[model samples]
Target: MKADVVFINGEVLTVDKHNSRQQAVAVKENVIAAVGTNDDIKSYIGEQTEVIDLEGKSLVPGFIDSHVHLTIYGTNLLGVSCIESHIHSLEDIFTDLRKKAEETPKGEWVRAWGFDQLEINEQRFPTREELDQISTEHPILVIRTCNHMCIANSKALEIANMDEHTPDPEGGIIERDDNGQLTGKLIENAHMQMFKVASYSSEELSISMKLASDAFIKEGITSIHDAGAYGKGSETLRIMQQAVRNKDIRVRVYAIMGSLTNSHDFVHQMVQAGTVTGLGDYYFKLGPVKLFTDGSSTGPTIATRQPYTSDPKNSGIIYYSQEDLDCYLGNAHKKGFQITAHAQGDRSIEMLLDCIEKALKEYPRNDHRHRIEHAGIASPDLQQRMKELEVIPIPNPVFMYVNGDVYKEYYGERINVMYPARDYQEQGIVAAFGSDAPVTFVNPLLGIHAAVNRKSKTGQEVGEQQKVDVLEALRCYTINGAFASFDEERKGSIEAGKLADLVVLSESLLTIDSARIKDLGVELTMVDGQVLFKNEQLMRPSGVRR
Candidate 1:
């Protein structure tokens, strides 16, 4: 049979069961027609086939980002960046937002994200009063890098009807001053409420979704688990379907369905509608029922069994009680919905495990593949429990690169066990890697680099004992991610029958220095036998497009 496209003279890292490497690949229609040496695939190429000579570049299965807030990441692209690398102080944040405010229409919102108070010189969040100075004419909302908290200027708070007398919402904190006035810091559910007031329009969301899809393809990510829809799952699901039909979203998505607020009702509605995980098509599918059990590790708000070393009196935030988790998760489990939650600390991990364990006892289902998003600080005991239940842990090792110093300060020795890629490997657990985009960046190379080195950006070996090799790291981003989404048989590897979702890298990951892995560029990204992104600068002269 004639192939639709042929890639030859490439180092093809299949990341399959045997960790095999091939020299060429041929795509027929939307699936891999063959994977072997150049001679093996040359026979499949026809005159009409798009034969691209790789010139010794590296080809691997396209990255599968197991967790990402796609819409949020897209919108973040539109907002002012307050990341430490971009802005080093609160004054810098004001400068950037002020510029954005001037460009925006009065009475509209001026938004920014990716600010970490710990990284800034002030070592504190930009106050609402300070943000108000940028533009009282426009509402200002600046989300912390963790996404669990944000600071809203007076105008935005006014729009949300939040006053000095506004009590904190359940499972959230509206910080107050010594005199009991609004400090303008909204944590957890309070942040969600602010989001409701500044929510994006459908048109805006469509634009952002397209932007996010483009960014994913540029970074060689062909499949992603859209961590949240940003509102009600049912409505968001329909919007996603429409986006797919409209050709706005190019990458494959496993749309995770749940809400941070009104979660019970969301879960009930999904169950009642007979929606379960693995629903929908190859391009888009319904993923797990997700819930947030705790806050972000970088925020130092993850519910740990012990108090953070930096704050003796605080053990971080747990969003729900064990009973509540059991109730919410048990009901979904009984309904055959694959369940997952944001459990980042040992305490939160333990709490979630209890609920999963209870659910299985009541309604045992083999190969459930229930997942723990972040599973950021699983201890030995927690790891044992995860293995026993056969639950997958989707850990964002990239957190180690972006927020490792904070983790070191807050959790102390816990850094060594945090993410724990090596431990997961030894225990035979299929742990998937995620970027948690907009929290960190969306590049899978960053995650792979962090996993291999276990080093923070500042040269600190945050978790030396937890380091995994390059091939192992690649597996987590590729095959292991596919396993988490139940799409392993169809995509994830460069096997003959698998979908032709592949990425050509400027450098071979297996041969690159661990520290330099994050620097490698994507030469091309393809999905369903179609090229979505190509770096013209890196293209070989002999690589001709049909």
Candidate 2:
């Protein structure tokens, strides 16, 4: 068959077994037909083929963000802006909120995310009274960057019936003052009380998913492993599944189901209902069951081996009991489902590794592909266990960029030990990189740049010794990400008979200076022979010549 589209005069990094870099590539019906020198690919091009001169640009496999919060990111993008900007004080936060209120209609709930108390001068959660002073009528809720915590204005607390007498629920905390009055801060499952009352409609969730899909495609992301999917409603999941079936989604999604109040019952029902891991086709698939083992480091809520240097009274909170976790894993493993546990601190990582090791020994299933999402602080011994068990560690490299300052404040000299990506590599563990969007930015280049530089988003170095090279960072986003999702054979590289998911870049990342890597731009993104996003715009059929 004649080639449908041929890209010539380009540097193509194939990312194959040999790491072969080529000059030209030809595509026929979405699969790569040829990858070789310009003269070699020219034979496949015919009069009907559309030729694109890359102008000495670069081409590689479409990026796969191994961890992301699609629904949450979309909701935040539409709701309010709090990321990628400095809010130094309460005055600055109120200024931004007041501006948003002006644009938003009165009485409508004002939902915002990505606030970090540690980043602000006060280093404290804003109170309900502070927000009520701005607007008593509107229900304003601002989520912390961790997503494990949030602060609700008085209106929101009233709507949720949370008052001085309201008791803290299991697995969550409602911060209270010395006088036993609610302080507007909610952590973990307690955040759900207000969130349930503030949840969006199915229509709104659908819009959010569409918006997130568009954003991912624009950044050359053809596939993403949604880190957590919760409270978006069953209808929202159905809408996403249907969109994938109809080929409406431009990128593939591997969605990890969120933990529930009765997680064991939930996983049981989901499995019995015929939902299995790797259930669907290319566009959508059932990933692992997500469990939050602990909280975020910035919040001083992560379960650590030692007490925080800043907060002597606190160690951290555990979301699940040891018995509950073991039971959940055992049942899920029996049902042929993989588990991806969110563990950040050293203690949390160690506990989860123990559970996984015990479960594998008891269950003994081959190809389980169990993973630890955000194994940020693994000790040397734990690293050896991770490699021995072949468990995957999906780290958020973007966190290093966005939260390094907070790390310094909380852990002091221990900041280097946190987010040990280089250690994972040295121990021969399969470590993948992702941008936990909404907590950080969604751009993979920024994540890769942060991984390679070990520099914070504020342009300061945190763990200079742990820095990786550009090619290694790229593998974390591409090949290692594919391994995390079990899609290595079909995607993650440019090869014959594989799906034609690719990204065309304005510059060659391999040849560029490390400092300038973040400036790289995506010129085009293609998924399964269709142009999804092109040059900061959505691509339509008319613009693409087949």
Candidate 3:
């Protein structure tokens, strides 16, 4: 059969069930037509076929980011970056915020994202008083890297009606000074409420989604399990579908239903509407019922069984009681909705497992792929439970690279079990790697690097025994991710019948210096047999040869 496109003379990592490798692959329509040696695929290359030579670069399955916030990622891309690489001190942040405030009209909102208090020179969140230095007329909100917390100026707080007298809401915290005045720090639900007010309009959201989709293609991410949208989960799904309809967003999205709050009762609404997971087409599908068991891993609010090393009084925060969790998950489980929760800490993971185990006892579903978003600290017992329960751990190993030092101090020896990828592989558990973008950046290569190297950005080793080989890491990003979404058979590999989603890389990750794997670049990204992103400068020595 004549093919649409044929790629030859390169290292092709099919990332199939057996971890197969090929020399060439041919695409027909939206699926892979053939995968074999260059000579074997030559028969499919007709006169009209576009044949491109890879020279010596590498090709692999397109990345499947299992957990990411698309809306937040888009907003971050458009906002001023305050990440450690960009700003070193609070003064730098203030200067940027001031500039934004000056440009924005009075009484308008000013925003900045990705500030890690640990990375800043001051080593603490910028107080509300300091943000007031930017503009009292305009509300300012600076988000922490964790995305679970934020520091808002007095204006924004006043708009939220938060004061010392405003008691901390359930599953959230409103920090106050020793003198009982608002400190401007909002955690969990408090942060979510403020974000709701400061959120973008539908028009702005469409633009942001487009920008984020463009960036994802550049990074070779063809499919995304969008963790959740910003506002009401249902509304977020609608906006995402509209973006896909408008062709503003290109990546296949499996959208988790529900926001961080319980006020919406999205699960109840979906069940009432007779909806279940996997409810849409390939471009946009409704994923599992979403819930949060705990807060951010790096923020030290992951609800561990033991107290944090740095704070002996605090063992972290779990959002729901056992009865509440059981009610939420059990209802969804019986209703045929695959359930997933943001359970990062050991205690939180245990809580979720308890709920799942109880639900299974009452109504057993053989293939329920209930998932834990971070599974940040998976103890041996917890891993065994997860294995027996067939629970999926969507762990982000890249967290170690970005926040390993803090983890070391917070968890001490328990750090060895944090993101235990090797243990997951050995135990035959399907653990997918996610960036948890907007919490961190959305580069799968960095995740792979952290998984293989088990080292931090500062070269500090973490859980060395948990390191997996490059091939294992790739599967975690590709096939494992597909398995989590129950789409394993159709995509995630370069098999003949699979979706024609592939990425051409600047270097062979299999043979590259493991230390340098994160530096490997994407030369091209293809989705549904169409080249969506191509780096002209990196497209060296390639031509359509008849």
Candidate 4:
């Protein structure tokens, strides 16, 4: 039978067992029909087939970001950028905020995200007073890059009814000035209050998701395991389902319900309502329920055993105690739902291990594939426990590029095992790499670069011994990601009969300069035999030599 499409004259990295290399690949319908030499594949090409010559480029399985916030990633695109490159100082941030305030109608929220105090020239969080300078008439919110913290303008703080008199919520901090006045800065659970005044409609979420998905395809990502669904779970779930039905989904979406939204009570409610995993096909499907044990390490709020070097008194915070986590995780585990918790610090990681170990002892379910997202800062014993339980660690290596230096400033001597890549692999753990997008850049290549380089944005190495080579990093982004989703057989590798989700790159990572890995571009991205993105100029006609 003639194939639908054929690619020839390329270094086709079939990332299958034995790590085979091929010269050509053929796609038929929505699956890979053949993987062989150019002569063998060319024989299957017939009239009406779209023949693409890679012209000596590299072709591998499409990237699968094991964890991300798709709608959130998309929504942030609409807000003020406020990245290091965009705004370098508090003045620059205020200017952008004031600009957004003027553009938005009065009393409406003027929202901005992705601002890091460390990256800004001021090297401090924007004060409530500073935000007021932008606009007191507008309720303003500027989310930190870490997303665990945010600063609200006075109007926003008032809209949420937060004041100096209001006591701190459980495990969440509300920052105040020296005079004991609200600084309008909220950390951890306190940030949830901002959702009241600043909210996303289903319409907005759907639109932003499309935008984010489109961007994902351009960067060669064929699938994303959405960490937290849009807004809460109910309305957002309906919207996502509708997006899938209406053909609005750009790439494959495996949604993980929000931590609170997928709570014990909520999971039972959802189960009673006939909502569960395996409800949809490849384009969209329900996966696990997400839980957050602690905050981000970059926020310095992640629970850790050792006090931070910068703050000797602080050992970070844990949102849940041992009993609390067991109750939350046990509920979902009993419901036969996989759970992925955000465990960044060693303390939080250990606590989750304790909970998981207890849960498994009670239920004894094997091959559950429960995951620990951002499984950062593991000690030797903790790493051993992670392997013993077969819990997959979805670590975002790209953090090395952005937060490597910050990690050192906090953990100091203990930085060696932070976000361990080689250790996980060496100790027999199914470790996958994900972007956790909008938290970091969404490109897998950059993640690959960071994994291979272990270098910070400023060229400082935090944990050089933990670095992995390009192949290992690629596997973490590809097959290991699929394994995390239990969809390894269907995709993830360039194997015959597998779904034709492949990406064509400008060069092979193995042969390139490791430092320039992030600079490599995706020439084409294919999903289910359909080319979702293509740099047309890069594709040559059949029979064309490299």
Write down the lDDT of every candidate, Cα atoms only.
Answer: 0.88, 0.79, 0.88, 0.83
lDDT string, candidate 3, 1-546, tens digits: 999999998899888878988899999999999999999999999989988888767899999999998988997876778974668999998988888887888987788899888888899888999998778999899988888899999999988888889988778899998999998999987887786677777777888899999999999999999987556667777888999988899999988876865633776777678989888887888888878888887887889998998899998887889998898878889999898888899999999999999999999998889898899999999999999999999999999999998889988989899999999999999999999997897999999999999999999999999999999999999999999999999999889999999999988888899999899999999998999998887787544465
The digit string of per-residue lDDT tens for model 4 on 289-325 reads: 7677888788889888878888999988777678978
Off by over 4 Å in 3: 84-86, 543-546
Error of 3 at 122 (Å): 1.3
Indicate whether candidate 1 or candidate 2 has the larger lDDT: 1
Q: Evaluate model 2: give its TM-score.
A: 0.93
Tell me model 4's lDDT, rounded to 2 decimals. 0.83
If the candidates were sorted by their TM-score against the true structure, best first, what order would they fall in? 3, 1, 4, 2
| Model 3: how far residue 409 lies from native, Å | 0.6
Give candidate 1's TM-score: 0.97
Better of 3 and 4 by lDDT: 3
Q: By descending lDDT, how would the candidates be arranged?
A: 3, 1, 4, 2
Candidate 1 yields a Cα-based lDDT of: 0.88
Tens-digit lDDT track of model 2 for 361-412: 8879887888988887676777888898889988887787888877877777
In the range 291-318, model 1's lDDT, one tens digit per residue, is 8888878776889999998999998887
Against the hidden reference, what TM-scores do the models get? Answer: 0.97, 0.93, 0.98, 0.96
State each model's C-alpha RMSD to the native: 1.5, 2.9, 1.3, 2.0
